[model samples]
Structures are given as structure tokens and as C-alpha cells.
Target: MDRGKKPTTFFANRNNKIYMDLKDIIRENTLRYLPAKSLRRCTSVCREWKLYISTPFFAHNQSNSFHDLSGFFCQSHSSQPSFISLDPIAYGVPDPSLKFLPEPVDIRCSSNGLLCCQGRTGYKAYYICNPVIQQWKKLPKPDANHGCDPALVLVFEPSLLNFVADYKLICAFQSDLDGYEFDIYSSAEGSWRTSGEICFGNRQIVPSTGVHVDGIVYWQSRSTVVAFDLTSERSTLIYSYSSGSLGKVNGKLCSASIQGSKLTIAELSNPYTNTMQMHSKTRAWSVKNVTLNDSVFAGQTDQKSVLFIGGKIVVIRLGSTLISYDTRTNDIKQLATEVDYDPRMIPYVNSLVEV
Candidate 1:
């Protein structure tokens, strides 16, 4: 405002160097709340802005601050990957089908910003890719070929201390020593190894039913939930329940069961330290029951149709309509219609983490 003074947009100069201005400090904190796709575009605004968004600390901050539902990557054996954006403007990938990979891939598992897809071109090798940035890494073949549909789950948690993304993939394949063994791959070490822990007995585990929470990965079998701890490298039979959708809520593992309009959300006590939880059949308490009093849920009685997309409750009803129920404000919005029902609608989180 004054000719004699510089505007507040610049810094209060000292020691022959200009420090960050008040305006930039506010913007730096604010930009962390934006999605990775938005932040990547903002990097080209200017050199200072590029430097601000390029920092590992900034990426970590943004990941920590905003992990809400972005969208879903719906895929099946019949079709390529299709993105169903819950918020089109705020969250999406550059390529929904992920054509940027070396070859067409089957979307196996997704965690945080990374996707673990098995390539169709070469030996059906596994690939870890970040669709937001179009970066991918082909993993060396595991010690065990998990057949056609392995119970594969990717584990990734953004660390405040580290910015470089690291992940692990666990394949629950059949073992000769009775039942199942985990063929694990670690990105940090860049190698695959098999764990000694064997899940004994015949368990019908589905690949689409696998989910990673905290450090443990759980898969829904025909009648029980089998868990494998990444730290302990052991597999245990955790919670035994009927066929339902397994998901996480507010950092705790929960399962969702839908019978017509009556939706039951059960919060399972996943005690990692207590081995007793594995042996004993502990019940999952129903934390909440939501009734969708509308035609959207008319006769769809599939118990395993709920998906945790961000903080919202997303339900794919009968393969025709996609319903999103707001858990916070009690707002109901139909995200999409005429959608094909692919049992596995992978919840996608757009992030800047490299492959």
C-alpha cells in the first residue's frame, strides 16, 4: 500500500536473505489439505511453489491431513478398470484403466496411493504403481506363483518421518505343509520371501476379501477371518463370523453386513498382541445400524457389498446404482447409477507417493 514499503506478500528481509512471507506460510499449510492430483498441478505454478510441494515433508503432511474418500476403481475379469469418482473435481487419476503400465493389468490390491496390479503381458508379473504420477515398478516373481487369483493384499501407511513410499505385498497361497503360507514382498528390501508361519487346515480364502489394517492383513474366509501380522510374521485365525464385507473405521477393523435396508456395522476387537483372540471365537459388536429407507436397497440382500471410501459409507447395490451415505453429517448422495456390479470395487486414494 505504501511506496516506501514492500507488500506483505514478500518476506521481512534479514541477513541479506528473504525468508518466507506470511502469505506463503498460510498457503503452505493450506495446500497440504488438497489431494495429490491437485497438488501435482499446483507445482507448475512457480519455482517457489514447486519447491514447496516437492518436499517429502509436505507430501507426508498432505497424506496425514487428508485421507478421505476420493473414488473407486471398479474392475472385473470381463472389463478393464473403470474409475467411479465420488468427487470428480477433487479426486481422480489421470488414467482410470491404468494404460500407462507396460501392459494391461488386473487391479489386485490398493493401499494409500499405490496399486498392486498383476500384469497380463509377461508371466503375469506383479506391478506396483502410483496412478496419480504414472510411475510403476515391476516386482521380481515371488518364490511361489499364487495361481490365478491369489489372496494378495498390499500394505502401505504414509509415515510422518519418511517421505519415500515403501510397501509390502502378501500372497496367501496354498502350502504343502497342510494349508496356506504367505509369500511376502518388501519394497524396502526389494525382494520376496516366504514366511514360516503356516495357516493350517483347508480355508477358502478369497483374494477380493483381503484388507490391510495397521500392520496386519486380514482376509475373509468362508466362515472365519484369518489375520497375518507383518511384524511377527505369523498367521492366526482372528474373528470367525458369517459372510460379510471386511473394512476399517476410525483406525479399527470392522465388518459391514447388509440385509435389504438394514445395514449392520460391527466393530471387531483386533487385538494384535493377544494370541487368545485368534483361538477364541470373539464376537464383533454392532457399533451402528443404518437403514436406507429407499428403493436403492429394495431387494439387494448381498451382505458383502459395503466399501469404505474415505470417511463415507459407500454401497454398490445390485450392480445398477452406487450409493454413498455420509457418516458424519447424515447426508445421502447418489454417486453413480447404471454401474456394473463388480464384487471388488477397490477404494482408491490419490497420492503423490512414488512407486
Candidate 2:
């Protein structure tokens, strides 16, 4: 070795290997914490990084850590939809305009940050999109070609099966006869398949939005509850005295009915039983009553819509005024008032859910 300069001898190869391992660990943690938008841009960084971020496990973990209510998707009278951020402190900027939706589309339903929309004038187009990420996919039209309006439900849960790429879109409509039929579109299958037909006898499937509980979907009819098992592809009708307005309250399937100014909530409960049940015992529903203040019921002649917006907060919409009733503290908060139309507000949480 020369006296003036040091030779090329450095740290051992084992030390360099350890340093690279630490670098990889740090990179993974950093990628996991990044928001969905940034992580999507990072996919083009390198081949290895792209593969890692696209994996189901990585998407699942990122979704679990990044769970938060981004905002509400509001549809105005002009049939144009916009996203209003719920947290003004975090996203105080102007409301984001939705450019992904078609010009004249009907805003149907939303679940787990995904919106299910259909074309107003045609039956060929159906879309599932995430307004936050501006990502959308057009669904293949169902096999049945009917003109009846279909009830739509969108279900997307990233934490299930450690995958964020799976989703289910269900469409139920009245058949030509006096019965109801369903068509389910699965991302795994990439096609729409018709499910079993359910004859309502004399009763009809009262038009209402579907409420998802666990993995099953429930719809309230006149005097019964239609429960669709997404896993088994079966439909069950349970007799219920609910008001045809169904929602999930405190993580349980609940039904709400408004009588005068009193709002009644009933939850379906399954109790432990040791004996063999006869004819598939029906689950019991416990009832709780909450009286709405005069302000909520003032100048409201039309029927009110009730929805549970997670965390014990019940949203009541009567005409143009939107009121939120907190079940925990018994406090009522007015969210918004005087809108262009009756806002179809859905409980939404932003995630990196790929449809």
C-alpha cells in the first residue's frame, strides 16, 4: 500500500451484505406507509419495486394502515357528481370534481370507497370507480336484457383474504313474472352470472339500497328481509317488521323506521342455543328508540332516509337538511343544509382497493 493514499481494502463482504439487508427493510416500511397516490406513482420506479407494490399482501397491509373517511360523493341536480372532503382540516382545499364518471350517469350506490354507477339512457354501461384515485373499470353488461331498474350494491373489502383486488357488484331487479332475479359480477371471474330466482309470491321487492353485513348483503322489502349470501350464491327471505330502510349500526344488520318524530332502530341478534333448531330458527331483532328533535322533522313532508355512517353516528336526511345523530353521546349535529337535491350520502372510507 502507498504511504500517501489508502489501498482499496474496505469492510468485509459480510458487513456490506448486512447493510443491504437493512436498506431493503427500510424501503419496505417506507413503501407501506406511503399513501395510495404516491405508491401508485412509485410503481414505475423499478421492476422489483413494482412487483412488491402490486402484490396482494402489500396492498392489503397498506389498506389496513391507511383506513380513513376521505369524503362524501354528492350528486347534484345536473346529474354531475362531486366529492366533498369530510375533514376540512386535512383537505381544506376546494372540493374535487369527478371527471371519471360519464356525462349522464345515475349514481347508484357506494361501498368501501367504490362507487357503482350506471348510464341513464342506456343499459350497456355500468361502472365501478374510486373517486379519490380517479380509477375506474367498465363492467360487462349482464346476460339478462331487461328494462326494469335494478337495485345495485357494491362491496369491496381489502383486508379479506389478504387481497385488495377482489370485489363484487350485485344487481337485483324484478323479473317479467311476479318474482325477482339477481345478477352478480365477480372480479375473480371477470363476468356477470345470473343467480337464483326468488319468487315474492304476492309481496314485491320494495326498491331500496342493499346494506352489506360481514360477507352477506341484505335488502329490506315490504314485510320481509332478503338476505343474499355472496359466498354461497343463495338467497334467503327472513320475515321482518322493519321499515324497508336497512343499514348497519354498530357492526350489526339494523333496520330503521320513522313514526312521526320518533326513529326506531332494530338490530338482528343471534343468541346461543344448544338444542337443534327446527326449520332454521330466525334471528331476533332488538329494538331501540331515538326521538328526533323538532328541528329535524320541521318542514319535511317527504319520506326521510336514514343511514348509519359508522362509529355510532346515524345520519337522517329529510328533504334538504342533513342531520347526524350520535348514538354514543345522544348528540345531534347538523352536517349540511339546503342542497340542490336530496343527497344520496353513503358511508365511505378511502382505500387502495383495486376493482
Candidate 3:
């Protein structure tokens, strides 16, 4: 080798070693701190990064404290919808069982790892089952006079009491001209019983999606959020938001959503404010607002909220597409397409079960 070109081999090896170390650090710390949106984008970069990021550690980190499972963005073609599992994060990986659900229909998520799916083709029966574990049971039509919203399903929370371990599945339907009525069914009981009718005034909007928080299913319609406590087996009004203020929160039956996590309750305005409160420790909420180009906050705001993911507040927008917001880095990115499933079809995100 010429004297002027000396030490090229040693320098090349040294640089390669440094590059390798940096890549390892990026893989480890990136999974730790990167928002799910950015992490997902990194996975799409290449195969090596995909394998590194799709590990149980990464998935577990992305998993909610309530239940970490793959949520499907599905569509229906039949009247009797069924629960089938799909790899939501995996890119085009065909799921053999996913083919069985040829007849797509509307789906609603419930507690105890159950999903309530109704068909679009006919007035057949409603199917309630867990897609992950594949343990499913069906429900025939409600009583002759009892017509409930097959889209509504009640889910039960996990109990520490070993002897009294069971989950509840509830559904809402129309019985009379009054409005909407509800029925309660328990896996322990295996029977449907009348709960009550919920009549939201014309001014109050009932969000199609009802989140179970604190042993009660909560829903936000136009302005009101209602809760139905399972222990008492009754519905109770929780909170209501005015027209200007958009109220949206997500979770199953647990305090995990409001606690210190990636999920947060933020306020965004012209100043771009964001905040999250801990419902357990304090009633107070953390607030932050920024002055950014109008285009930044231009997306859909009504279906916007911060979700708790791995102890961080991630902004989620339900629109033509699903967007997750990362507050720590002030990053906004799209996670899934709106064509997958309507956010209104299945309101809750977490699958409540030991999957």
C-alpha cells in the first residue's frame, strides 16, 4: 500500500465498529423512547429494523397496561359478523383464520376479551367472542319484544377474587318507542337480564363508542358522558362537555387510562394547549398550549385525545385516518388508515383478556 494511503484498513474497521455500536443503541433506546408512530415508521424502513422492533419487548412496551393485544381494523360483508384475529402491525402477513370471516360486518368490543359483531346482510343473530384466544360464544336474538343494539356489548373487568372470577357482557337495544334499552349478561350467569333504558335528551349526544371506566361503561355523545356501574347494575351520568369543548377518552373498565401514562386529557386551542390529569391522586389536570401554524392543528379535533401508552401521553385522532401524537417530541404521524375500520364501529382499543 502507498504511504499516502496508509492505515485505510484499520480506519475502516474502527468506523464499522462505531457504526455497529450506534445502531445497537438506536435499536434499544429507540424502542424505549420513540412514540409508537415513529417506531412503526422505523419498522417499515427495512427487514432488519422490523425484526428488532417487533420483539415481545417492543410489543409489550406498546401494549397497554389494561390488555396488550393486536386490535384489527376490520370491515364486514354479512349480517352475522364474527371475531377473527389479524396482524394489525405486521405488513401483509396473511392470517389463515382471518379468511374464515369472509362475511364482514360491524364489530363492537366488550370486556373479558369479547367482541360483539353484527352482520350487515340480515337480521340474523349477534356473535360475541374473543378473537385472540379464539374462545367465542354466540347470542341469539333478544326476546321477541326486546330489541337491543347488537353493536353494544358489556365487558367485565378482572377480579382478584379467585372464587368470584367472571366478566360481564351487556348489550343495548330498542324495546319500545321510548329510546334505547339495555340488558346485562354475565359469563358466570350465562343468561340475559333486563338492565334499563337510557334516554339522552336530543341535545345530548351519545357517542357510539362507550368506554368502561371505574367498573362502569362510559360514553360521550354530543355533550354528555354516561357511566353504567356493574356492581349496582345501573346507569349513572358521569360528565358532560359543552359544544365548544370536545370530550373524548379511551379505555376499558380500569383506572389505567387517567393515571400517569402515555394516555392524557389535553386541551388544544389556537394557542395549542395540551394537558393530562391523574384521576386517582388528584382531580387536577396538566395543561400545555403552544403557538404553531394553523395547519398543524388543522386535522380533526373532535375525535382527538391523548392515550396512555407505556407511561407516556400519545395524542390520538380518529378521522379519515388514525393518528397518534407524541408530546415528548412534538411529533405527529399516521398509524393506520380509516379504510381499515370505522372508529365508531368499535370504540374501545384495548382487548380485555389474558392474551
Candidate 4:
């Protein structure tokens, strides 16, 4: 070691200049195979590299469209969920607050960068809020009635590169055991239509969280996965697991959630295991299992919650610490918590968004 010179100065001097040839090569080669994790790490390597990577020209060429997108998770002690914008890049740490919509009572989203927030009024009234632009659009309710299911889902279709949203709301409700009726609303037409009665499904199993990927709303209904398409105006079945077999997973709903640029479903193995099974999006269910328990997942309820953020899988369980499963290294890392040995705020860990 050179006693006279400091380590920081030595490295900085050695890596100071920007090589145009090297930069061009990296910019070209990375467009086809740039790994998001590597890119983030590279940004911290040096200032010149960070500027090149952060440039709009280079960022546009990245493989995935939504590289750093965050899903907003809201929770509160009262009925109103504590509204906090979270950046999973910071691992559940609070980000800036959203000022566009009035205390959101309900919300649905789209891949084209739009989130529709419905205030306690249900389907009829909504505010289309774009997290990117930080703007809001209040729209009138649809005339048709769809029963009482107020579940909203956003669908992002990649092939079409089009964004669509679906509102699964119930316009009428009847007592007894006949069946609860509801209608699906569309963001394109701004109207509501009857989707017929869902007799086979459980009325009490409406999904609160959903991923809108590839033009379909992937929602978990108690034990089943119901996918509703906004373009086709049709509903299809993706998967239905046995009770306690696997829990829910969240993302913006698109093929990007799938590994290797393919569509896949990521969920827990069981209520007990700390392993997560990612079902590759294919005709034949090709499944890949990743164990995230390396001290990151431990305990009862804290090991089950999982959501796909950017290109990584984030696990947040009750009382457990927040951790992100890095697809780059195939490993899980514990994110810095607000405090040492701090119990995760109830619903706070769940309210993670990467916006």
C-alpha cells in the first residue's frame, strides 16, 4: 500500500477519463443484454458511467420498459390507509408523497403510466393519476350497474404496447345465497357493462391487489387466479391453487414480471415454506423455485408476502424485515430498516411502491 496516497484518490485518478469508444460499445451492447442490477451497480462505480447510464438515450434502450417502476402499497391504523410512496430501490423506505388524487379510497392501474383512483364512490367516480406526470383526471361514473364488487385491476399489454384498465364493481346485491352480481368497467370507453353472474366463484373473494401485465388483470380470488382482459372484454382462468398452497404476488402486471423477458407467476410455495415458486408463462406450467430464506425470510407470517418490483422479487412478512430477491445474483438481501430490530409497521411493509 502507498502510505502517502489515499485509496479513494488513487482509484478516482485511475478511473477519471471517459473513453468515447468504450462508452459507445457499452451503450450499444447493453441495449441487448444489460442487466438492471448491473446497471444500478455500475452507476455507483464512477460518475462518468453513471451519467451515461442515466442518460435518456441509453435508458430508452434498456431491455425492460419499466426498469425502476414501484407499486404503491397503502396501509393505515384507521380505514384510510396510510398513504406513503415507497421506492423498493430503497426497500420499503418512504419516497415522496403523491399529491394528485384526494385520499384514495380505491385504485386501479395501467401500464401506459396511469393509475385510476376511485374515491369511496366506487366505479362511477374516478381520478386517473399518472405517477410519472404527477397529474390527476377526475371522471364521471358509468351509467351501467355491475353489482357490488369494487375490485379494480389494471392490464398492460406488451405486444400492443397499449394500456388498459378494468373495474370489477358490483352494481346490485341481493340477500340470501343466490349470487352476488357485478359489472366490469373499461377505461378506454369510460363505461360500465354487465359481465354476467359469477356463480362458481366466491363473492367474498374479491381481489384487493392485482397485477396488470400483458393486457390482463391477474387477480387472486381467495384460491383462484382470475384474469380479465380489457381489450377483449373477456375473462379467463390462469391458475387456481388449493387453499394455503400459495399466497398472492404483486407487480404492474406485464410480461416483464416474468423472468428472462418471459411471463411468469411468482408466489410462495406454501404458508410454511420460505421458498418462492415462479411459474414460467407457458402453455405447460414450467416452474422455477427460488429459496429466499437466507436469513431474509424467517418466521410465520413474514415469509409469505411477495411482490415483483422492477426485475426483482420483494418479500415482506409481518414482523419480518424487508428483503429483495436479486435476480442478478439469485440471492436475497436485507434492506436497511428504519431502525435496528424494529418491528415492521403493520401494513407499512405491504405499502411498498417503486415509483
Candidate 5:
């Protein structure tokens, strides 16, 4: 080898325009798939990276790729809340128990990266917080009494230009009849507003069964599936005679429940389809029934919580075990053993979203 000159190595192309373009393209695409924590740290890598990561479009893209279930905030009246992560690296929050707040809270509902919690003290005010960033916002209490078991649903849809997520919290206040009315709190307005729509004359909305998908929030009872559209501000019965739990599976509204040894997972096929066609000749759901190998199940299956771990995975409590059942593969795996019986588990997505 000639000692006078050095050979061009792999990084010698670093100065080339085409090489730089390729590197930028790869970096941008790779950044979109990283976990939110890594993306938060990536902002400090460089000013350009920082600007890109902070963009709303980038947040939307990253959110689409990072929709995996981090874990759940298991809430109970007897004990303090707990975080149960399926994978610590992917689903862990900075403070799982939400100790950063001023007071102890009951984790009511969660959407995207935010949580709706009711304070255990002083009029039981509501709070919305991002546990990953340890930021929270206290909401003004509504005029309606939510009662002991309030029906609360948090709705958040991250748009391409929506970096600071504008969320809506729907709380069902009881009507004079057996029905319930909703008080929707908008984060953008920093206030609560009552909606005219009422889940009227129906059984009380099951607070734990609430799940938001698309722009609609769903709560299923033994007789029907009740929904409130965030855009239209209307409550509609989506499904009927559905004794199941509501969750989002594979990016669609799904209902999962265990009956005896058989597991039924129903997907809400089309809510926007022609309503006349839906009510008359067709059903809005496409369902799948999976039979389990074991018959052992937790007590009070009717009231037990059903949570979706991620894509095609349903987590339910069996005795003291938290088991995740894969609907696609019919595989069952134990997530947490010796869990609280019939724990009120609210699914949490660990993200860098701010309150």
C-alpha cells in the first residue's frame, strides 16, 4: 500500500449529496418506528432531528407505528393502583402508579398516551395526565353527579397536525329515569360541556367497558352496545344483545368475552354503513368464537374486565392470573400471576404526549 495517500473507506461517502440524502431518508423512516421514549431522547441528537421529531406529522406517524399496548393501570378500591407491563422496554411509563399527581387518583379511562383519573380527595375532581412525561391537567368538575361508579370515557385521535392532543372526556351523569346523560370535557377549551344526547332509559353505562375507536366511544352491556360520537355529539345503540367486553383489536372496535370454555371476539364491521341497511338486514359486527383448552375462569365473568394487550391479544383475569389470549393464533400466555381478582385494568399506552 502507498503510504502517501489513504484509501476511501465506507464513511468517505458521508460528504456525498446522494449519501446524505439516503441517510436522511433512512433516519426519518427509522425514527417513526422507535418507541416514544427513544424518540424523546433522539430529539437531543441534533437540531434537525429535534425539529423533525417535534413536528405534529412526525408524532402522528410515530403514533401509528407505536400502537402497541404498554400495559395496564390496575385500579381497585382496596389497594393502590399498579402498572403491569407486558414488555418493560416497550410499555413502561415513567411513573406507573401515577405518584406525580397532587393526590391519589382512580384511573378511570385512558386514550393514546393520556389518562383520565378521578381524585380520591376533595369533591373527586377529574384529572388528565400523561404518565410517561408525568404531566397532568385538572379539569373543572361538572354539574352532574357521576355517582359511585361513574361512566367515564376518554376520546383521543391523534391527527397529522395534532401534536398537542386535543382530547374529550365523556362522563355519564344519571338522568331522572334509569337512563344516563353525558358531560363531555374538552381539553382545548379547558372546560366541561353537556351534550344533549342521552343513553336514555337504558341500564347504567358500564364505566369499565368503555373504549374509544375512530371518533366514537362504546360501552357494552348485556343487552346492547351504547355509543357516543364525539363529532356528532350523539348517542346511538350500535349493537344489541351483546354480552361481551369492548376493546380495540387490530385497529378496530372489538368485543371479547369468555362463555364457558368458548371465547367470542366480535369486530364491529361498519358503523358508518347505511343505518337502514344495518338495522334491517345486516348486523354491524363480524364475530369469531374461539374455544379454550381449560375451563378454569375467574369468578363474576359478567363483571370482569377484558382488555386488549395489543394486536389480536385479549387480556383477562383467570382466578389470580392475568392471561393474554391471542385471538389470531388461539394462544394463551400468562402476563401477571397472582393478580387481584376482577381487577379494574385500564389499558395504558406509554408515549411522550404532554397534557
Candidate 6:
């Protein structure tokens, strides 16, 4: 054996080990940052890679890495439902481009990356879907009639025990009697059950969409704000400002009321209990008034709506035009769009959660 050949063998073994270590590091990062659809296709690569991606720890971190504002699911009476992306760079994948539904459906509400929709035609059917993954499941029909229009809210969270997702749907409708009835559907039970009823002295108007903060859902009525506790299945009323829109800003429930030229924002403090349930008693509301910019109105006489787009940004819309107000910087900017129809915008986050 030659002395020069001995040094060559030593260098070859060292380089081979370094190459194997680099391959392992790349595999770990890919599982963490890849989109859901791309990750699904990666499972076919090899058996060891498939096992690593299938773990619960990887799934939880993958979801957190992809959780952010992706786009909005917008629908109006004049046009079909469409999902418009806000940031395509963060999306990291091609648009899902899902346009058709089994039947004509109305997107009523959204929570935790899930959209709650109902059938437009004869039999009343409900659906829960993740638009990015294009996966959906049809809910079982309720026992009692939901009348012509029913108020509904959906809550969804992905399970850590298994890869399956868990969801709940709550419906509020007018009863034949004087009061209103509430029904709740549970995915764990796979059935719909009736909850307690609340009798408002006069008829109350409930909005189609509600703001879900923490575990409580809030809907505004003519005179009071209705609060529903998801954990306890109980409903209560909080006597805050009426005739205003409800939204969540910086993890607090806020209401924006419009006066002649001033916009008043009231935020509720200590609204929930220690166990994360909504308190029955009314809480204090901290109020702040912001003078309106005349340019925002633009001499429009139509009704306007307010929506909180996370953080300090609040959007006000009259028709097709949208004005966004930043609380931190006191800056105002109009949102631009390419669509022809007036989009009903809401705060949305894109995720890899599959139903």
C-alpha cells in the first residue's frame, strides 16, 4: 500500500459524512415551511420522509408557520363567491381556483380558516370548508325548521390527537312562539341539539355574521349585544352601545359607532372569566372618539360598514370604495381592487388546516 493512497481514503470518508448531514437538514426545513398541497405530494418521495412528516409535532409546527393573512372569501348578490388573495408571496403556492359548489351556496361566516356556508336552494344544507385546501364536509340537517333566514356561526380547530379537525355550528332562528330558539351542532356527537331559548320582549334582528374572540361569539342587535358562550352553551346580553358594528382589535371585543362626524370605538375589558367563558355581567367599555375625514365619505348617502382587519387597521366601506384607518399612525388609505363587484370584505387568515 502506498502512503499517498492512505490520505485519499481518509478525505473521501469525511466528505461522504458531511453530505449526508446536509441532506438531513434540508429535509427538516422543507417539512416545516412547505405548503399543505406540496407537503402532500412529498409523502410519495420516500418511506422515511413520509414518516417524519406524518408526526403530530411536525403537523402542529407546519400549521403555525403557515398561519397568516392569505386572502378573503368574498361574495355579493351580483356575483358568485370568489377568494381574493392579499399576499401571494406568503401563500407560496398556486391559487386553488375553486369556483363551483355542488349547489348554489351563500358564505355566511368564517372562523379559524374555515368558511361556513349554507345551501341557497330547497333543502337547507350547511357546509364547512378550508378554501385553500379545497376540502369540505356537508353537515347534517337540523331537526327543526330554520325558517327563511337563520343566523349561524361556525368554530373550527384542528385536532392534535389525530390529523382530523373538530368544528361546531350554532344556529339562531325565530321560534313559532314569541321568543327565539337556539340549536347547536357538534362534530364529536355527530348530531344537532337544542339549547336554551331567550325571549326578547320585542322581535330582535340578528346579523348573519358574528365576531368570534377567544371562545365567545358576539352579535349586535338593535339595543343590546348578544354574547354566546361556546364552552357552556349559554347566551347572555351585554348592554353596550347599540346600532354599531362589532369587531376584534388586539384581542379585545370592540364596537364602532358612528355619530354626525365622529366615530366612537368602545372596547370591553375583562369580558371573559378565568376559565375562558364569557361573564354574565356586563363589563366596562373604554371609549375613544376619532373625528371622521370628510374625504372618506365622499358625499355618499348610502349606509356604511366597519370591519377590523387585525392589529390597528380598521376598514370602512360604503360601496365599492374602501378606506382603511390605522390607529397607530393615524393614516388613512383606500383599498384597491381589480374586481368589478362590490366585495364584502372580512378579516381572513390562510392556513393548511384540512377538514
In terms of lDDT, the poorest run of 10 residues in model 1 is 10-19
Candidate 1: C-alpha lDDT: 0.76
Arrange candidates by TM-score, descending.
1, 5, 6, 2, 3, 4
* Error in Å for residue 75 of model 4: 3.2
Q: Across residues 29-49, which tens digit of lDDT does each residue of candidate 6 receive?
A: 756676555676778988878
lDDT of 5 at 347: 83
Candidate 1 lDDT score at position 73: 84
Ranking 2 against 4 by TM-score, winner: 2
Q: Report the poorest 10 consecutive residues by lDDT, candidate 5.
A: 296-305
Computed on alpha carbons, the lDDT of every model, listed in order, comes to: 0.76, 0.67, 0.45, 0.42, 0.75, 0.67
Which residue pairs clash within candidate 6?
Answer: none
Error of 6 at 194 (Å): 1.0
Q: Considering only N, C-alpha and C atoms within 3 Å, which residue pairs clash in candidate 5?
A: none
Clashing residue pairs in all predictions, respectively, total 1, 0, 33, 22, 0, 0
Which residue segments of model 3 deviate by more than 4 Å?
1-66, 69-103, 144-151, 159-165, 174-180, 196-207, 242-319, 327-331, 337-355
Candidate 4 TM-score to native: 0.52
Error of 1 at 74 (Å): 0.9
* Model 6: lDDT of residue 85: 48
Off by over 4 Å in 5: 1-26, 37-65, 270-281, 293-310
Q: Which of 1 and 5 is ahead in TM-score?
A: 1
lDDT, candidate 2, equals 0.67
